[model samples]
Target: MNRSEALSIVEPHLTKERFEHTVRVADTALTLAGLYGESQKKVEIASIFHDYAKYRPLDEMERWITTSYLPKDLLSYHHELWHGPVGSLLIDQEHGIKDEEIKSAVYCHTTGKANMSKLDMIVFVADYIEPGRDFPGLNEVRDMAEKDLLKTAWMVSRNTINYLIHKQTSIYPDTFHAYNDLTKQLYGGN
Candidate 1:
């Protein structure tokens, strides 16, 4: 599906606020993609579908996690994280979006993974720093996003890790992997 088509498909499932957030994320992703010389279409599609399943019922999300063969450990964490992987799967299985890059961007947008590409980083950072989002330290990341994609991505990843730790929430392993990978990219690889 194309951009408008994808937006219509997912928009019905989201609340008004979430739909607006998705639009902001898509806009932010397009900006980041332009800065990084990535594909605008891919980033737009990935950002649009990144939260396609955000409002899905928890039981339905659990079903998607179980039947889709997603890691069982996902359920051990907050169910809030389920939409990323499950939405990616649904966007592929149901919406006919087979691009692995788009799918991976949606999959890892929440708790990013190791070895993400430029599109993935753009989508992830865009979602976090989208204008609708206002959190402590976000201005720093947004400023960094303007100048350095890698630094912005790393800041967002580390921010998530630190927030979860402070909340005593179960930390997803992919978050750490993404943090470490981006750390090496920003500093020196070992």
Candidate 2:
């Protein structure tokens, strides 16, 4: 589906505030994609659907997990990271989005994984730095997004790890892998 059609499908599921945030993320992703020479269409689609499953009731998310046969690691990280994969499932089953890049972007937007695609990075960082987000260090991330996409992604991965650590939450292993992989790529395997 196209961007407008995808947005329509997700709009009813999100609160008005969240819908607005999605729009902001789409715009941000497009801008960042242009700067990074990534596919703007993929960035737009990924950003639009990044949070599609975020507003589902906790019980419904759990139900999806139970019935979808999602991996055990996902269940282990459910409290923190279930939404992304669940969102991917919802998009596929409900929205008929069969594109691998789109599905992968939605699947990994939360608790990013190793060897992320360009669209994945765009969606992940766009969600984090969207206009509605007001966290410390966001400015640095925004600047990095404008100047260097890989650098911005690496910073976001580090920030996510730090936040999880500070909260004393169990860090998802995929997040650590993502950080390591991106850091190595940005540093030329150093």
Predicted structure with the largest lDDT when compared to the true one: 1
lDDT (Cα, tens digit) per residue for candidate 2, span 70-158: 77666676465888888988888887888889889999888788999888888888989988899899999988888877788899999
- Judged by whole-model lDDT over C-alpha atoms, candidate 2 comes out at 0.86
- lDDT for each residue of candidate 1 in 70-153, tens digit (9 for 90 to 100): 898998988889999999999888978899999999999999999999999999999999999988999999999999999898
Reference-based lDDT, each prediction: 0.93, 0.86
- The local distance difference test score of model 1 is 0.93
Q: Cα RMSDs of all predictions? A: 1.0, 1.6
Clash totals for all candidate models: 0, 0
Top candidate on TM-score is 1
Model 1 ranges off by over 4 Å: none
